[model samples]
Target: MLLSIDWIFIIEKCILIAVIIGISLVVAMYETWAERKVAAIMQDRRGPNRAGVFGILQPMADGLKLFMKEEIIPNLSNRFLFVLGPGLAMLTAMMTSAVVPWSSHLDIKGRMVSLQVADINIGILYIFGVVSMGVYGIMIGGWASNNKFSLLAAVRGASQIISYELAMGLSFIALLMLTGTLSLRTIVEQQQDHLYNFIYQPLGFFIFLICAFAECNRTPFDLSEAENELNFGYHQEYSSMKLGFYLFAEYVNMFISSAVMATLFFGGYDIPFVNDISFGQQHGQNVLAILQGLSLFVKVGVFIFFFMWVRWTIPRFRYDQLMRLGWKILIPLALINMLATGFIILLRNNGWHL
Candidate 1:
């Protein structure tokens, strides 16, 4: 029965997975380099120009350094969970990309092949579930380290992520109501026929964007890793490549978050102001697919740069302030946005009748 099954499809999916993972790792690696360069430009200093021209090889050098570093596991730590922590973080970071629609379909030997790995019905929900699981990685790593500071940071991270997720889910409710579908590809298709969801749900988008920062443990919301307070935060006891995995997972999460934001609010692979179907007809399906892929990456790149820019420009938020903003402010706003969206949708369905 297995042999009779469509092995070609399985092979194609495996290849796609490999390609996507490769691309993600490459992007995450360079994000470290880009972060430094952005900081340099903003701070008016040379960032990294030693390893190669403009220090293009710096990320490789850094990776090599991490690989060569001594791996040290605390004697008091849980050996199994200690090793699993960063691996889980890296795994969850990459998992979220499975549902993201990278581009329009590619015509491969008269077959229409989707660029996305899985066009699941509940793509958004899958993202949320995976993102929520990401906290477990931090929590386990912190707890297993057998350090008070690590535990405290982990607790802080867990609380912060949980608090903001309420606002994030509520904000997404408004978008789901607007799109009327859980499938991400369908949502992108719907946007192609109309204005981007951002126009309709700017407040929701704002809330989601803020929540995304918190979710990814990025600046202003990066209370868990507050250097001054927690002494480098949850992974304090970690060293070598394990520590590298935790840090590298962060950039991967950032990349995925940027892609999600771009897909949900900005139209995933759609070229702005260009009629995609017409272009595909004018050119070819494969050519069009390539351009659309480039378009999506460009959007993702812009968001990634914005993430780096904000990190350099904004300081980390106080824990109290972060909690207050997430619970008191963003939650209420998200609820209001959801209610207002539903009300508007109901009215439009009834021709604006009372």
Candidate 2:
């Protein structure tokens, strides 16, 4: 019986992993389609409707093109690391998904199946670590390419991520104080019972949101790939599927970052104005699980749209301006937010709790 149970557990987890990873890829694919449609709408032109209805098949077509394109390796490049670069970039982007709780557990035949891949105690830190490591993809590829422009782009990307991650970590300190736990599950649960983090940590959320954009290398902070200056930047010499891997990784990062924001600030999978935790106990767990999961994705979709919107709306920031914003503006704001949160928590603890 124990062996049977263990096999069942393994199967359940395998299914969940496949579903989440598949969903991430599918969402990433459509985000490219949506981005073009959004850009077309903004520019008052028809978007990609030629391939399939409303360009639904455009991503597949693009993928096929990438696969069919002639693979190129610059004669001077480090062949192994050149290959490792995109793979590493793609790996780091997907790694962040392991800790995200997609929804409350579903009750299946008296066994609870968790929607998350992993419930690591230090989920947020895991996300931070993986995201920080993503720059290595660009760095490795650029250095391997034996191209000066690519190397420059890699350095810019590395510097930009490092600068923003500092403020990002500082921003989270305020929320961490309120939740008092590093676990993403705990954070989500606390929000379900109490108020969402954003309600109390608006300033922290603002700082985090901006840093997230910077972390994902979105416009207004995408100086790393500034075309005119860097000549297509890191991966400039990459071709075919390798280039596709780099582009695909960006969209994946954006998707995961959006999901992270949704989980942290938007109450994750908690259904609003309802006691979903209690409702699950009284009602059917399966239904509640689905609804809660849907709620989380709804929030994620909104964030993704917001990301694309900002890309079309905002101009890219100059390198100096980007560094100044991170160091001078965002870091100071995050520090202040953290300090204030600590003071408030102390006050509430010492006879100030209502």
Candidate 3:
């Protein structure tokens, strides 16, 4: 029975999962430093340069501070749900990475190993489902706090996410119309041989990007956390590592969202203007895989920078404006884009048939 089990595959997957989790955590950590640095540059001030060379160690210091801080649970709060909120948020954030193809497959010894944790057929759907659950964390935490402000912030967050998700899903439907596959790995593979989806689905990508901003609770859609309105927002009652978990989850979600956007719209791990397969044949699979992984990371980095840039540059939207944009504007645009994509695909298919 032991011999029948593919131990090598299991071990490979385990290692991949651990590496991915580590990478996600590290990226999330540095994103805080990057955010501050970017803000300082935009504001013409020094950020966190005191700690370890241009503030590179600032995130570590911040983590240590959070760890040392007292863990406080509000007296009136529901203890079980209060603890569960941040845990659920962090879990959902990490879970999204399971389906993301980090790079092309790497050949280990004689066997080919995929970089993705679970390249399930319903990869995109899995992401949507996980993201949908993330809102529950906010709601539970806020309601458990037994604070009216926290409950209001949670309500705002849940509504914002729900509103934008409709447009985001609709935008994805247009991409699905083009790709005809739900598998993210397959989408990237297709793009390797052709133009990236962004070129073909520009409108869809635009809608998706805007919806992505809203989904991540980034400004100009960050009404839920508007300091003037909600104080500290849904996680207001959390302290110590529990509060850190909520903060970390947001950054992790941003990183994963960047990766997902890169994979969907850009040629994920596909070296631009380079025939990866031929290059791999000329060089070796390991070298090619490393380059591919770097390529994906580079794209992800650019997207993350863009996210930070917009957050610093833009102002938060009014609650009414956010709802209007999501329901009235984005949804209609997404619907039209989806219809147009279908029409174009139908025409092309008929032309090919003729």
Candidate 4:
């Protein structure tokens, strides 16, 4: 059995998982710094310059502060569930990254090394199921806090997630009809040569983008975290690193959602308008792989920026407005988008020409 083991393959996959997880943690940490820098620039003020050369080490400082804070628990809170809540939220957030194709395969000494952790056939379904479970984190945390405010925020968050997920799934159904496969790797490979899904599914992309905001509870849609009414929202009672986990989970979710969006609509890891295979032939395979990975991160970066920009630029939505947008506007538009995509696919099957 030892002789038959594919040591190289196992090691390569292990390295990939470790690298991906490390990158996620580091990026999520830095995103806080970036958010502040972006906000400061937009407001014409300096931000976080005291910690380390323009606050490059700000995230680490924040982590240290949280770690050093006094751990606090309310007298009436459920001890077990209160702690479990943030951990569950973080676990679900990190789990979504496993299905995403980070980059093209690497040619490693007569073997191929894939960057993805697990490429199940029902990849999209797995994503949907796991992401839906993320609501439990906030719900449990809020309910266990034994605070009316936290409980209310949890209720609103769960409802908002349920409402928007419907539209989000409908939007993806249109893309599924186009690709006819749930494998994210297949989707990326299909769009290898200047054929991004966004070009074909613009309406679907828009619907998905909006639903993504609602799903992630980003601003304009962060009704759950509305400080004025909810008094610091669901994690209001959490302290120290426990509270840090909740905030960190949000950034992690944003990063993973950005990656998912890039993989679905954008040509994941494919250099736009450039033939990657041809470029690899010109350059070396390793060089090409590095470039493709960089391309994916660039797309993710733009999306992350968009998330922060919207947070600062757009005003938060009222509770009623948030519900109306999801149920009344987004769901109807998603239905239309799905219907249109089906009609186009039908016409194409019937040999209808453009």
Candidate 2 has what TM-score?
0.96
Measured against the true structure, the TM-scores of the candidates, in listed sequence, are 0.98, 0.96, 0.97, 0.97
Q: What do the candidate models score in CA lDDT, each in turn? A: 0.93, 0.92, 0.92, 0.92
Best by TM-score: 1
Count clashing residue pairs per candidate.
Answer: 0, 0, 0, 0
What local lDDT score does residue 62 receive in model 3, on the 0 to 100 scale? 99
Looking at candidate 2, the ten consecutive residues that score lowest on lDDT are 1-10
Clashing pairs in 3: none
The sequence of per-residue lDDT tens digits that candidate 1 reaches over residues 1-354 is: 546878788888899999999999999999999999999999999999999999999999999999999999999999999999999999999999999999989999998889999999999999999988998889999999999999999999989999988899999999999999999999999999899999999999999999999998999788888887658889999999999999999999999999999999999999999999999999999999999899999999999999999999998888788888998999999999999999999999989854
lDDT tens digits by residue: candidate 2, 259-297: 999899989999999989678888899999999999999
Worst 10 residues of 1 by lDDT: 1-10
lDDT of candidate 4 over 18-118, digit per residue (tens)? 89989999999999999999999988999889888999999999999999999999999999999999999999989999999998877878577888998
Clashing residue pairs for model 2: none
Best by lDDT: 1
- Weakest 10 consecutive residues of candidate 4 by summed lDDT: 1-10
